[model samples]
Target: MPRININLSHQIVKKFGLAEVDDFGTSPEFYFASSVNLPKNSAFANSMKSEVEKYSFRPTLHAPFMHLNLGSESKEIAETTRKELQWAIDTAAFLRADIIVVHPGYTALPEKKTIEHTGWLDNALPNLDFIAKYSEDKGIKLAFENIFDRDPFSLLLIKEAIGTSNIGFCFDTGHYNIFAPLDMQDWLEALDGHIYEFHVHDNDSTGDQHLPIGEGNIDFTSLQNYLVSKEISELPVVTFENKTLDFVKQSLSRIREWEFLKT
Candidate 1:
């Protein structure tokens, strides 16, 4: 059976009445915890490490993206993002997480100021190099996710420039619904062979609704068919990025009931 993971935030834990880290599912995707609780050599991080060992769970991480902007035009802002991401990388290493998810951090520039003129590559590439190397040294993979892009062009460019095996993609379906001007299949086609994970959720194509599967306009059948066509060596990690545990559970059940996925 394919492994299905849920992205755990404080809200989910509260709703589930889970008192300990081990109460998380066997495959846990840890979202960024409260920054106030995260210090250098954080006990919170240590407890997570211990829980992973105790339960023998395979873990993934969603790095902190609040106020992080790797492709910012401001030098200071970019530097701060780099530092915070490095810290996230360290935390992931401590937890022995296999993959750390990140946002691309590039915003659409003014019509005249293209990606080149805005220093998007200049700011993002070096950070990618450093993060990719750091993740490699720690035996973790960095998966850059799509957000706010009308097409896959920016991600494709970043992939081409970096060209590191340890660097991969985490396709977010809800983000695509909200932002991508092109068809979902186009994004999938462009990202084929690079996707290592997924943020699976539904949306109305006008907003990131994070609805249960089949409740929105997303063509999940096509998504399953696309996965079936891929010749990847391992099943990509499928994370239900939802508002609540109940919604995530509903999505999981719907995923299992998909005709193509059942095969």
Candidate 2:
């Protein structure tokens, strides 16, 4: 059976408090949405850590992704990206998190003719290599997530280039539904051994609605069947990305009915 988790941002916890998280009945995949939230010594970090310890919840982490590009051509930007990612890994270590998710730092450009010509991967490789090594040293795994990717090729190339056991993929269902030219089965097959987690949510195929599981057009039944067909003894961690408690509850109820998940 898969371990279930919910996405809880630092901003949300700070604004609302952690008490409500108990109602979700799952471990949290804490999102440090900004570089400012990655400092390990901050009062907020300490307080959050204490609360997590008290609850005895095993956690995963989502690293800061806004305005940060691991593939930036500018040397200064690359350095800053590395620093921020290192801070994320350090914070994850402090929180005793096993997996920290990050974006692939790829944004499709209209002028770029090919994936290689886009220059994102070439520029990002060194930084990715550094971070993957750092995460491994800290006993933390890095899950590179799909954002604007039209297919799984880029992520596959990244996994091969980095060539590290600590690095894997986090398949974002909403992004796949929005941006992918290929089907979910293609993605699962291409990324077979590389997938470590899932950022699961629903979308209308027109936008990233982050709706409850059955509220959108995504076929969750097919996904569940694929996992079962593979006979995967252990399933990837499923992190609900629904933005509201009600939506999350709805999604949870829906997933609970899938017999494969109940095992």
Candidate 3:
């Protein structure tokens, strides 16, 4: 079966706190709910993590995206990011989990230093080094995700520099919806053995609407074909990162009943 996971956002947990919404069937990919409780205090986060433990589903945690950036330009911001990620790492360890999905940061300022992308790389590589060593010491596998428009070489280089058995890539389908330089198939092929997991969601291409499968324009069939070609279908675990509960439930149902995997 294709491993289906749910992105556990804080919003859903808040609803759970109010009145538990029972999950009747299995949620394939237990995508940790970073979108919902991203701004909560450590105590609150721990509480949510406890709730996650209550579920019978298997989980993969995504580090929070707010107030931190792994790919920050400023050294101070970068160090702060290191600390923030460490918090998530510690949380995962406490939760007795193995997988942690993380984003690759980006630079957006026009007036920022023209370090030529490679120069920007010089400053960021050290941060990746710190994370690689830290995750190793903790005995955790940190899956660095591939996001679009962010420097591609930077991600590849970081993967090379932070050489460890615990590190690999978490390919997000929506992010690939916008991947530059290489086409999506080529990109998927390049990361074949290196891909540790996936953030599965669909978008309209114009915007990241996080639509459930078959509702949006993402060609999941084609994507599945590539996964089969790579022999990834066996250990498949895809976290539906959509926000709507209805959509999340629908995504779970469709993936469980997906025709792509049936044949």
Candidate 4:
């Protein structure tokens, strides 16, 4: 069985009534720590590293997404974004993370200077290639996650252009529900073998609710069946992106029940 994980930030631990990182009992099989929770400084990362190691929890990283666009047409902004992402990659490596999740750069198409969605390929490819090499050198994988993408075809184009084993896909369920024009199966079939992680959350088509699994319209049974048939060779990391510990626990229980019912 693929290990289930939860997204944890400093705020989440605090909300759980825990005063310190160690105070929170380590029951989660894995954790996806937000880059904001992990600053780009060594001291902070090192401090948390001890607590994580003590629990024997495998870790992965969610790179800072806000304003960190690898596809920015402006050279200066793109360069800055690249550096910031590099820091994230380095920090992930420092923590011995198995993989780092990132957003596929977005574009406002029909811009006066840029080449629609394809323009993202310009800056995004080179920077992704750079990070791919960096991750490979550190023995970690980099998974580009989807957000606001209308379809998977554009992502396929980017994936094909890169064509590196170091780079993989991180499918976000809530993002697909709210932002994608197509269904989850369409996206799954498009990136079948390359999926390394699943940001498992729920939302209605109208908004990104981040609700517990099985609460909204997404059919996890269908998703699981597809994965069993298509991606059985690899056990992709599945991280619940619910906001609170209560919701996260509920989502995990829901998944467990679903798995049990399937059996």
Candidate 5:
């Protein structure tokens, strides 16, 4: 069965406590979405590590993504991006996390016709190479997630250019429902072997609402069928990115009913 994880930030854990997470019977995917959430000192890091260890939970991490552009043309912006990502890698290593999720740093703009025209890959290559090697050395995998990408091609390009097993894709269902120009099946096929994890949430296709699975129109049954067809020996980590505990529990119950996940 795929390892189940729930997305929680430092603020969330501080507010609700890990006992609630323990009750849910799922590991956590710690989301450090901003610099404020990143641990500032060893004491803070050790505290979190101790709490997580107490529960015997193996964690994953979501790197800071706000206003971070790995492909930025500005030298300062590029340097800052790499620095923050390196911080995430170091934190993940300290926490003994299996992988850290990263944003691909692409957004749709009117001036650019395609990713190549935007030069995102070109500007991002050096930083991507650096981070990929750095994370690999720490025994951590980088799962580049889809944000404003219109299709799988941009991520595919990154994978091909980086050409490293330590780097893989994290398919976000809500992002795909809202931002992807192609269908879910197309994404699954294109990123077939490279999928390392999933940010599973649902939205109405009108917005990134992060609703429970059944409340939205995403065809999760198709996702299950794809996994079954592949006869995968190891399933990717499934992290619920819902907004609340109720939604996470709802998604958990819904996914547990899926035949492929039941095994």
Candidate 6:
């Protein structure tokens, strides 16, 4: 059965001061902001890690965003992205999280449209190779997310180019809504054997709005039923990736009540 999880963004939560992500009431620290840097064995990681372990909620991680990126066109930026991902992976391992979500890349080409798919492949393969190898050694699966990007094809192309078992996919549902109109099933099939995680959220027709589960137009019931049927063997980590904690928590409450019911 699918389980409720949070995407720890402690800074955002601290700003709002709303607790419990909504009334459905699961611990938000581990699910959302659990992987950020905290004092080593000093009260912080221990306290939050203990909170999650006590609850027995499965943990998943969203690596630092806006700060690091694996697919930066510049070498220095790319290295920073790689290091941040390594930190997130190491922290997830410490917390016993089975999965980590990462944005696969931005355009390796400054002019993505001018380049053919083959040329883009030439540029991204080495970076994917490094991340995939690092993930294998770390024993944590790495999932490249599909953001509504500036590229021409899709991140799926990169997934194919660096065809290694350690690398997988996390399809942000809002991304499809933002950039394309394909139904979720079609998106799932396109990802096929590669999908390992998900960022479940809703959005306005105009952009990646990150609205509550039902507040926007997505059909969560259908998506939930399909995921359940697949019995995804990897313990797929579903994150409520949104802008605000209260709103995200509220959306999670509805999801737990209707979609991921207690089994």
In model 6, residue pairs whose N, Cα or C atoms come closer than 3 Å (at least 3 residues apart or on different chains), thus clashing, are: 6-31, 7-32, 8-32, 8-33, 21-249
Residue 155 in candidate 2 has what lDDT?
78
Better of 1 and 4 by lDDT: 1
Candidate 6 per-residue C-alpha lDDT over 59-99 given as tens digits, one digit per residue, 9 for 90 to 100: 67777767444555677977776666667777777777777
Could you tell me the TM-score of candidate 2? 0.93
Q: Model 4, stretches more than 4 Å misplaced?
A: 13-43, 108-117, 230-233, 260-263
RMSD of each: 2.8, 2.0, 4.3, 4.0, 1.9, 4.2
Model 5, CA-based lDDT = 0.85
Error of 6 at 15 (Å): 8.3
Model 1 Cα shift for residue 243 (angstroms): 0.7
Error of 3 at 216 (Å): 1.7
Which residue pairs clash within candidate 5?
none
The true-structure Cα RMSD of candidate 4 reads 4.0
Among all windows of 10 consecutive residues in model 1, the one with the lowest summed lDDT is: 17-26
Which is better, 3 or 5, measured by TM-score?
5
lDDT of 4 by residue, 45-146 (tens): 565666567766677877766666787777786777787677777877776678888876675333222323466777677787787777788888878888
lDDT of 5 by residue, 1-263 (tens): 67788999888877776788878888888887765565567566677788788999878999988878899988898888999999999888877788899996777744335666778889999999999999998899999998877777778788888866798999999998887767788888898887889999998999999999899989886688776665556578888999999999899889889888667
TM-scores, in order shown? 0.88, 0.93, 0.80, 0.84, 0.94, 0.78
Error (Å) of candidate 2 at residue 16 is 3.1
Cα shift from native, residue 87, model 2 (Å): 0.7
Worst 10 contiguous positions by lDDT, candidate 2:
108-117
lDDT winner among the candidates? 5
Once fitted onto the true fold, the runs of candidate 3 whose alpha carbons sit more than 4 angstroms away are 17-56, 108-116, 150-153, 179-181, 229-236, 259-263
